[model samples]
Target: MSSPSANASEVLIVSARNGPIAKLTRDEAEQLFLGRRTTLSDGTPVALIDLPAGPVRDRFYLLLTGKNPIQTRAYWSRQVFTGRAQPPREAPSAEQAGNWIATTPGAIGYLPADHADSRLQALLPLR
Candidate 1:
Protein backbone atom coordinates (compact mmCIF):
# COMPACT_ATOMS: atom_id res chain seq x y z
CA MET A 1 0.00 0.00 0.00
CA SER A 2 1.01 3.63 -0.54
CA SER A 3 0.80 6.59 1.75
CA PRO A 4 -1.92 9.17 1.13
CA SER A 5 0.50 12.09 1.14
CA ALA A 6 2.76 10.45 -1.38
CA ASN A 7 -0.14 9.63 -3.68
CA ALA A 8 -1.48 13.17 -3.43
CA SER A 9 1.77 14.97 -3.97
CA GLU A 10 2.79 14.13 -7.53
CA VAL A 11 1.63 12.50 -10.72
CA LEU A 12 3.89 11.64 -13.63
CA ILE A 13 2.48 11.64 -17.14
CA VAL A 14 4.54 9.03 -18.89
CA SER A 15 4.99 7.53 -22.32
CA ALA A 16 6.43 4.24 -23.51
CA ARG A 17 9.71 5.73 -24.62
CA ASN A 18 11.80 8.87 -24.41
CA GLY A 19 12.80 11.05 -27.41
CA PRO A 20 9.56 10.18 -29.19
CA ILE A 21 7.91 12.74 -26.91
CA ALA A 22 10.12 14.93 -24.81
CA LYS A 23 7.45 16.68 -22.74
CA LEU A 24 4.06 18.33 -22.75
CA THR A 25 2.68 21.50 -21.28
CA ARG A 26 -0.07 21.25 -18.66
CA ASP A 27 -2.72 22.27 -21.18
CA GLU A 28 -1.52 19.70 -23.70
CA ALA A 29 -1.39 17.03 -21.03
CA GLU A 30 -4.92 17.83 -19.92
CA GLN A 31 -6.24 17.80 -23.45
CA LEU A 32 -4.63 14.50 -24.27
CA PHE A 33 -5.83 12.87 -21.06
CA LEU A 34 -9.32 14.14 -21.55
CA GLY A 35 -9.52 12.67 -25.04
CA ARG A 36 -9.66 16.05 -26.72
CA ARG A 37 -6.42 15.40 -28.60
CA THR A 38 -5.89 12.08 -30.29
CA THR A 39 -2.30 12.59 -31.27
CA LEU A 40 0.94 14.03 -29.97
CA SER A 41 2.59 17.17 -31.35
CA ASP A 42 4.49 15.03 -33.83
CA GLY A 43 1.27 13.41 -35.12
CA THR A 44 1.69 10.14 -33.32
CA PRO A 45 -1.62 8.69 -32.20
CA VAL A 46 -1.69 7.91 -28.47
CA ALA A 47 -3.74 5.62 -26.30
CA LEU A 48 -4.48 7.05 -22.88
CA ILE A 49 -4.66 4.73 -19.90
CA ASP A 50 -5.94 5.62 -16.45
CA LEU A 51 -5.41 4.27 -12.96
CA PRO A 52 -8.34 2.84 -11.10
CA ALA A 53 -10.41 5.25 -9.01
CA GLY A 54 -8.66 6.53 -5.90
CA PRO A 55 -6.93 9.53 -4.41
CA VAL A 56 -4.36 9.50 -7.16
CA ARG A 57 -6.97 9.58 -9.91
CA ASP A 58 -8.94 12.24 -8.11
CA ARG A 59 -5.89 14.37 -7.49
CA PHE A 60 -4.79 13.92 -11.08
CA TYR A 61 -7.99 15.42 -12.46
CA LEU A 62 -8.09 18.16 -9.87
CA LEU A 63 -4.54 19.21 -10.63
CA LEU A 64 -4.72 18.85 -14.38
CA THR A 65 -8.26 20.00 -15.17
CA GLY A 66 -9.54 21.81 -12.08
CA LYS A 67 -12.31 19.27 -11.80
CA ASN A 68 -13.18 16.80 -9.09
CA PRO A 69 -13.96 13.19 -9.79
CA ILE A 70 -17.70 13.79 -10.09
CA GLN A 71 -17.27 16.68 -12.48
CA THR A 72 -14.75 14.74 -14.51
CA ARG A 73 -17.13 11.80 -14.71
CA ALA A 74 -19.94 14.04 -15.87
CA TYR A 75 -17.70 15.63 -18.46
CA TRP A 76 -16.76 12.29 -19.93
CA SER A 77 -20.35 11.11 -19.76
CA ARG A 78 -21.45 14.11 -21.76
CA GLN A 79 -18.70 13.56 -24.29
CA VAL A 80 -19.65 9.94 -24.74
CA PHE A 81 -23.35 10.69 -24.94
CA THR A 82 -22.70 13.27 -27.63
CA GLY A 83 -20.43 10.86 -29.51
CA ARG A 84 -17.40 13.04 -29.06
CA ALA A 85 -14.90 10.82 -27.25
CA GLN A 86 -14.23 7.91 -24.98
CA PRO A 87 -12.68 8.03 -21.55
CA PRO A 88 -9.22 6.55 -21.11
CA ARG A 89 -8.80 2.85 -20.60
CA GLU A 90 -8.47 2.05 -16.89
CA ALA A 91 -5.61 0.05 -15.42
CA PRO A 92 -6.18 -1.84 -12.21
CA SER A 93 -2.92 -0.67 -10.65
CA ALA A 94 0.14 1.48 -11.19
CA GLU A 95 2.33 -1.49 -11.95
CA GLN A 96 -0.08 -2.66 -14.63
CA ALA A 97 -0.20 0.83 -16.10
CA GLY A 98 3.59 0.89 -16.21
CA ASN A 99 3.65 -2.44 -17.98
CA TRP A 100 1.15 -1.27 -20.54
CA ILE A 101 3.05 1.94 -21.11
CA ALA A 102 6.24 0.02 -21.57
CA THR A 103 4.83 -2.29 -24.25
CA THR A 104 2.31 -0.18 -26.08
CA PRO A 105 3.68 2.30 -28.54
CA GLY A 106 2.41 5.83 -28.03
CA ALA A 107 0.80 4.79 -24.78
CA ILE A 108 0.39 7.40 -22.06
CA GLY A 109 -0.68 7.20 -18.44
CA TYR A 110 -0.18 8.73 -15.02
CA LEU A 111 1.22 7.08 -11.94
CA PRO A 112 2.40 8.23 -8.55
CA ALA A 113 5.90 9.63 -9.03
CA ASP A 114 7.31 7.01 -6.68
CA HIS A 115 6.15 4.29 -9.03
CA ALA A 116 7.93 5.70 -12.06
CA ASP A 117 10.79 3.75 -13.61
CA SER A 118 12.98 3.42 -16.71
CA ARG A 119 10.26 1.48 -18.51
CA LEU A 120 8.46 4.73 -19.32
CA GLN A 121 9.51 8.27 -20.06
CA ALA A 122 8.21 10.97 -17.79
CA LEU A 123 6.53 13.61 -19.90
CA LEU A 124 4.84 15.86 -17.39
CA PRO A 125 4.75 16.25 -13.63
CA LEU A 126 1.42 17.38 -12.24
CA ARG A 127 0.96 18.43 -8.66
Candidate 2:
Protein backbone atom coordinates (compact mmCIF):
# COMPACT_ATOMS: atom_id res chain seq x y z
CA MET A 1 0.00 0.00 0.00
CA SER A 2 1.04 3.60 -0.51
CA SER A 3 2.13 5.75 2.43
CA PRO A 4 -0.14 8.35 4.01
CA SER A 5 2.09 11.29 3.07
CA ALA A 6 1.21 13.46 0.12
CA ASN A 7 4.49 12.78 -1.68
CA ALA A 8 5.34 9.43 -0.15
CA SER A 9 9.03 10.14 -0.44
CA GLU A 10 11.29 7.13 -0.09
CA VAL A 11 12.99 7.44 3.29
CA LEU A 12 15.17 5.01 5.19
CA ILE A 13 15.81 4.56 8.89
CA VAL A 14 19.58 4.07 9.24
CA SER A 15 22.39 3.61 11.69
CA ALA A 16 26.14 3.32 11.37
CA ARG A 17 27.09 0.20 9.43
CA ASN A 18 28.52 -1.47 12.54
CA GLY A 19 25.90 -0.12 14.91
CA PRO A 20 24.15 -2.60 17.21
CA ILE A 21 20.77 -2.64 15.52
CA ALA A 22 20.06 -4.64 12.39
CA LYS A 23 16.41 -3.73 11.87
CA LEU A 24 13.35 -2.08 13.36
CA THR A 25 9.56 -2.28 13.10
CA ARG A 26 7.35 0.67 12.15
CA ASP A 27 6.01 0.94 15.69
CA GLU A 28 9.52 0.80 17.08
CA ALA A 29 10.69 3.47 14.66
CA GLU A 30 7.79 5.77 15.46
CA GLN A 31 8.39 5.48 19.16
CA LEU A 32 12.07 6.19 18.78
CA PHE A 33 11.67 9.22 16.54
CA LEU A 34 8.96 10.60 18.77
CA GLY A 35 11.36 10.46 21.74
CA ARG A 36 9.33 7.86 23.56
CA ARG A 37 12.00 5.20 23.01
CA THR A 38 15.74 5.10 23.50
CA THR A 39 16.78 1.46 23.37
CA LEU A 40 16.39 -1.26 20.81
CA SER A 41 14.74 -4.57 21.56
CA ASP A 42 18.21 -5.92 22.44
CA GLY A 43 18.74 -3.10 24.97
CA THR A 44 21.29 -1.16 22.94
CA PRO A 45 20.89 2.57 23.55
CA VAL A 46 20.40 4.89 20.57
CA ALA A 47 20.41 8.60 19.75
CA LEU A 48 18.34 10.17 16.99
CA ILE A 49 19.57 12.63 14.36
CA ASP A 50 17.28 14.66 12.18
CA LEU A 51 17.52 16.47 8.87
CA PRO A 52 17.02 20.22 9.03
CA ALA A 53 13.57 21.58 8.23
CA GLY A 54 12.85 20.89 4.57
CA PRO A 55 11.07 18.63 2.20
CA VAL A 56 12.94 15.52 3.26
CA ARG A 57 12.34 16.15 6.95
CA ASP A 58 8.70 16.94 6.36
CA ARG A 59 8.20 13.91 4.19
CA PHE A 60 9.90 11.67 6.72
CA TYR A 61 7.60 12.74 9.55
CA LEU A 62 4.55 12.56 7.34
CA LEU A 63 5.39 9.00 6.39
CA LEU A 64 6.22 8.06 9.97
CA THR A 65 3.38 9.77 11.81
CA GLY A 66 0.94 10.74 9.09
CA LYS A 67 1.30 14.27 10.42
CA ASN A 68 2.27 17.29 8.37
CA PRO A 69 5.18 19.46 9.43
CA ILE A 70 3.01 22.01 11.19
CA GLN A 71 1.21 19.37 13.19
CA THR A 72 4.45 17.66 14.01
CA ARG A 73 5.95 20.96 15.16
CA ALA A 74 3.01 21.60 17.43
CA TYR A 75 3.26 18.14 18.86
CA TRP A 76 6.92 18.65 19.62
CA SER A 77 6.24 22.09 21.07
CA ARG A 78 3.81 20.58 23.52
CA GLN A 79 6.21 17.80 24.36
CA VAL A 80 8.91 20.34 25.12
CA PHE A 81 6.67 22.79 26.95
CA THR A 82 5.53 20.05 29.29
CA GLY A 83 9.08 18.71 29.68
CA ARG A 84 7.94 15.33 28.54
CA ALA A 85 10.53 14.96 25.76
CA GLN A 86 12.84 16.69 23.33
CA PRO A 87 13.00 16.37 19.60
CA PRO A 88 15.95 14.80 17.83
CA ARG A 89 19.10 16.78 17.13
CA GLU A 90 18.79 18.27 13.67
CA ALA A 91 21.67 18.33 11.23
CA PRO A 92 22.32 21.16 8.80
CA SER A 93 21.83 18.89 5.83
CA ALA A 94 21.32 15.31 4.81
CA GLU A 95 25.06 14.85 4.41
CA GLN A 96 25.65 16.06 7.94
CA ALA A 97 22.92 13.81 9.26
CA GLY A 98 24.52 10.81 7.54
CA ASN A 99 27.92 11.75 8.91
CA TRP A 100 26.56 12.02 12.43
CA ILE A 101 25.05 8.55 12.07
CA ALA A 102 28.32 7.15 10.79
CA THR A 103 30.57 8.61 13.47
CA THR A 104 28.29 8.77 16.48
CA PRO A 105 28.00 5.36 18.04
CA GLY A 106 24.45 4.11 18.27
CA ALA A 107 23.13 7.14 16.42
CA ILE A 108 20.01 6.44 14.39
CA GLY A 109 18.24 8.69 11.90
CA TYR A 110 16.17 8.84 8.74
CA LEU A 111 17.52 9.94 5.39
CA PRO A 112 16.23 10.17 1.89
CA ALA A 113 17.03 6.73 0.45
CA ASP A 114 19.23 8.17 -2.26
CA HIS A 115 21.36 9.97 0.33
CA ALA A 116 22.28 6.82 2.30
CA ASP A 117 25.58 5.14 1.50
CA SER A 118 27.92 2.29 2.48
CA ARG A 119 28.80 3.85 5.81
CA LEU A 120 25.27 3.32 7.01
CA GLN A 121 23.02 0.29 7.40
CA ALA A 122 19.35 0.40 6.55
CA LEU A 123 17.19 -0.45 9.55
CA LEU A 124 13.84 0.14 7.89
CA PRO A 125 12.19 1.90 4.98
CA LEU A 126 9.15 4.08 5.49
CA ARG A 127 7.41 3.70 2.20
Q: Give the number of the best model, judged by TM-score.
A: 2
RMSD of each: 3.7, 4.4
Count of clashing residue pairs in every prediction: 0, 0
TM-score of each: 0.87, 0.89
lDDT by candidate, in order shown:
0.81, 0.84
lDDT string, candidate 2, 1-127, tens digits = 1223413368988989877777788888888877687787778888889999998899899999899999999988988788888779889989999899999988999887778888998887877
The best candidate in terms of lDDT: 2
Could you give candidate 1's per-residue lDDT for residues 14-122 as a string of tens digits?
8876535566777778888777888877787778899999999999899899999999999989987898887888999989998988887778888888988777777
